[model samples]
Target chain A: MRVLIMAKEGEKSEAATPPTPEAMAEYQKFNEELVKAGVVLEAGRLYPSSQSKRVQFNGKKRTVIDGPFTETKELVAGYWLWQVRSIDEALEWLKRAPYDGGTFEVREVIEFEGM
Target chain B: MHRAIEAIWRIESARLIAGLARVVGDIGTAEELAQDALVAALEQWPTEGVPERAGAWLMGTAKHRAFDLIRRRKTLDHKHEEIGRSVERAQESVDLDAAIDEEVGDDLLGLIFMACHPVLSKDARVALTLRVLGGLTTEEIARAFLVPVSTISQRIVRAKRTLAEAHVRFEVPGGAERIARLSSVLEVIYLIFNEGYSATAGHDWIRPALCEEALRLGRILAELAPAEPEIHGVVALMEIQASRLVARVGPSGEPVLLLDQDRARWDRLLIRRGLKALERAERLGGALGPYALQAAIAACHARATTASETDWPRIVALYDAVAQLAPSPIVELNRAVAVGMAFGPAAGLELVDALVAEPSLKSYHLLPAVRGDLLRKLGRSEEAGDEFERAASLTENVRERELLERRAAECAAQGTAG
Candidate 1:
């Protein structure tokens, strides 16, 4: 199974301040777990909601609006996709993920037909 | 007069609604059709007398209503040619018995997962599950959750629109996808059972109708996926816990504590059924899942003749297994209670105090309630009174609050006695 890990809004602030040497080392240590487990098929942190966009479609017309989105829950600050066996196994691995205040929404990717 | 109609509807409405959903391919429309049939039955049953098979009559009437709906919609000549053809085909081949079995048994677990799909928020999932899968009226659900009927109605409407707009498939997922969907399915079942057991904000302590509905769904899931031990485990857990419903309340409707309940009043049939399901779960050959372990714990209580005779050590062990499977602060709190009962209050207090700084326990009422019990047992009556008072205020149930307050008074009386 491929699952996504996302960060809630206001979660990127910890990354904004220049990390102390020790903080930088801690961050490296965190990423090392993801790498060592071979679960980090792909991962990245977004630029933050201030640089986001809201896309809406009314009938056939598509409108894009600038963000600094008011609805913090609508934004994803970071994401990851991991290949795992089952939801239980994925949850077991998720317990080891380094999360602070914000919640990580985990979801399974819908496999396309004939893929 | 309406009560009889309601009793029949609660049992039969899910199948009617599911079958209608299949035909109409729109849950909102399906519900409207089912309600139409319900109204017809209400008006006719008194005059005509209730049919020999009330459920079959309801299903037959609802299917005819679905046929009527499709006919009316087809008259408008919709542009979705493929959809029209499928709806027409469904209408054409409408044998009541085949259709009933087809619709009623069409992957209920899938329907549950679809209802609790990740796109919807938790509140939305709960409202939709109650309305669609549980066959509960919006007003009934509103009363159960202590929310306005309009709020529940809006949640259901929005949930259906969101699923339709998202183009969520009605079919069950396969392989890893199925496993990923388990948590949502389990959460829905748990919510269903919890509402039935404690009825969060209602005059009743136990809503037997809702318990029966959840158990029926759980049993269906167990049969559908025999290889899924956890599904059987959940079914067993619900069955065993619900078996005590007969003994859970007094004739005058006050709540009955577990130890005070008469063991003879417990439903032996349900206990037997639960034990059988648990055995099937164990036969799957993995370390018992959280639900199965909890079922084992409940089975221990069911097997014991009296509270004094309970295998507290086995229950503590089962809780330990549950903690390993789903390590939550709540589970730890429960394990501490079992440990306290098995060993002594002091041992349990050690575990409970260790969790004082655990943030998740901050708002949980059980932490204070359990702490108070331990304190009372340890003869620290003054401290116990304070804890019980705090717990009483935190709990929302009127009956539970009253019981806690009474316990607090007892603690105070014990202090004076000493």
Candidate 2:
């Protein structure tokens, strides 16, 4: 089965500031482990909200918000498409990730049975 | 839908064969019945809307054929009459409902033992193992191993015929015999993995499907025999070695020496899995087997963040243990490499020098390659260049030869400058 493991960005976990080398190494090491296990099909870090735009729809009235949005409570910071035996296994991997703090969501990808 | 059917067949075919072989008392007939079920599925499934339980559907179809065989027992020849009698006996002992729900691990293990029975040649054992246990078609097996499809088909046919002729029982051996048979299975699996691992010099070396297949087999065996330390040991060893595949070759398809490989590029997940398997083997509590010992040595390299940080002495000690377990010229050569790193180039050169007179290693490229490295370290550039040239001449791999020749040229340039 496949699960998309996305962890929310913490208050201090914003990527606006460059990551320390140690942190980067730690993250890379963790990512490498997942990749080596053949578990990770895809993984990536998202660009910060600073370089993002938001469009709101109210009966087809488009309200655009540009630049950094202040509400950074539980926005997803990164995601990985991981192959795991179960949701518990994916959760276990998520718990061991390099994130200091974040709620991780494991979304099961729907597929035909036996695929 | 077609992909789903392939996936189901891949997962279910082995169990189907194993269960049928146990009931049918022979693998050849078991395979034929299974094939008939598969053929039936192909014809009916697309129109019938694939069954809810595809594997069960296949097994039920096969069992129905087995009953047909039972009814026609009176018309069979002498050998088949015996098989029919055995089937009748098996059916009497096995309740239909429980038989379908039976724990299949034992049957699968039996199938593994039968496939790797020492009566067959190593190539035949390998081909049959892949075909039966891996649920791979003959064409797929041939392509993976780079052999002709006809050859693989012939090997399978010959192997099954031999097993039938020899009256080989479709059951796992007991006690010490089981241990011995298990080793044969491990050796064949490891051989398949190595074939994939060594295909680095080829242009199409990106994903060695054989290695993946071998690993899948190894992982399944480990699960099926969790208490067997050697099983975990071999699994660990393969995982660790496989972890390095991404960094083991250069962009131009040249081999990368272990120390030169990018550590970050090594798969940490595999390393962790290997380490876990090693711990499991050790926890099983016995003197480490040859595979486990080798995994320990690989772990030493894996644990180190860099080449200089590697515990060379620990690796040397592990190699010493491996040499004790499986004393071969190859083990000695690898031990020399570890010894060199632990002591010094001079110390390593001494071990290499000893192996130089050994007949088995006379034409082995790595022996001279190790000798050349030691000589280079000792500042004997002129002699080192000659050794490298000899090593290059002995090697059949084009990329490796080029690398060795380039090393020889560097040594020549150094010799002239000095």
Candidate 3:
């Protein structure tokens, strides 16, 4: 199954740049491993929530709010698409991922057709 | 035909969806494929006569479509050339039925884990679990929870996204993870059964189908982890509670309180099954887990032939065990009831008074309702009537409200007669 792993937004120091050289190297190394194992179908870092806007539709007119939003309970920092034998396998791979300062969010992508 | 298909799907959809998820590697896709297969079944079954082994037919059809999708995706992206080649090579030798049969358990468990993942908030987890495992739709879940359908939908979408983003494993967690995850799983099942057993809203007192589904899932969990005492406790509790389903409502689906229920109408078979499960839980040993202790209390009531025959002391002792194992104001409240029955109404009244200041029980209608019952027993009819009225107003369930109101009226009538 394809699982998404997100780096938490709490690692503010590394939010803009890799906080430490070692952390960056570790991140790159893990990415390399994922790519080689064919588990990493796609992976990328997300822009910090600071620059984001949540567009809310109250009727037809859309209202946009600039971050920092009230709730930072969970914010996506980065993600990886992993192909694995089962969700357990996906978790095994997640345990190996680089999480220098933040939590990882893992989820299965829903596939739909005739959309 | 639609209702029949829906009924069948409700029973079989989780397995179908889980199987599809395993093969397609994405739940969203798997659900779509499953739906596609369902649509096909709807069109074909009425004309062809529903096939024997209908579940297998759905699985086969879903699997075929899933394989086709995988093949198409692999081939469309030359990037997956190796996968494409492997799919082509495997097609000739692969037996789909064997594949489907082998992975169903993991898939179902995976789906359950996914629904119960801790990443989502508690409300979200319960909503999603009921929707997915209980085969309830968004509207049904919302109606059950007394929430807007949009809110439920958002919760589900966010929950799924959270699990996906958190990289929460679809398969059941093991060791420490399982232990941690177990609490959430147990909580979800509890909420599901609670809604079924005593619905929070709507006209009915019990949604038996929901109760049965949750009980089945609990039993499956017990089988999956035989050594988990709490799982058996939960199963036992569910089984015992389910045994009373037949007696819980009148012909018109009105509420029937435990003290007023017809003992003769209660299913002896279910009580037996429940007692057996409780025994299994006890044999696992240690202090009685919260669920087992609750089941023990239920067993006490089940064993009694009539209200007067109830072993109030044993039930009170079981409640004390439950309180020690998992201390909650609710447990304390229940313990108070047992105390009232075992000793005198005044003793229970004192305990209930202490809980009035408890923040947790402040909004819990049952606290007032129990208090009212104790008051009535103590000859404080006026106060008891007021308490019942408050409880009736607080409760959202129509049947529960009506029952409370009736109790309040009875209290008033008794006071007038006196």
Provide per-model DockQ scores. 0.01, 0.05, 0.01
- Residue B298's lDDT within candidate 1 is 94
The residue pairs that clash in candidate 1, if any, are none
What lDDT score goes with residue B312 in model 1?
Answer: 95
Backbone collision tally, model 2 = 1
TM-score list, all predictions:
0.64, 0.79, 0.65
Task: Give the best candidate by lDDT.
Answer: 2
TM-score (chain B) of candidate 3: 0.80
For B1-418, candidate 3 gives per-residue lDDT tens digits of 5666665676568788877665555556667888899999999999997676677889888878877877788868879765575456446424757765656666787887778877778898888787766667888777766779999989988877787678565566788888778878988898788877775222432254456557767876676567889888888898889778768777666777898899988868669878988999989988777778888899999999999999999888888777777899999999999899899999999999999999877779999999999999989999999999999999887888998999999999999999
- Kindly list the per-residue Cα lDDT of model 2 for residues B56-97, writing each as its tens digit: 789888888887786667466556667667667667744565
After superposition, which runs of candidate 3 have C-alpha atoms over 4 Å from their true positions? Answer: A1-115, B1-11, B40-57, B71-93, B136-155, B200-206, B250-254, B363-365, B375-418
In CAPRI terms, model 2 is classed as: incorrect
Off by over 4 Å in 2: A1-115, B74-85, B92-95, B202-207
Q: Provide the lDDT at B70 for model 2.
A: 64
Q: Is candidate 2 or candidate 3 better by TM-score?
A: 2
Instruction: Point out the higher-scoring one by TM-score: 1 or 2.
Output: 2
DockQ of 3: 0.01
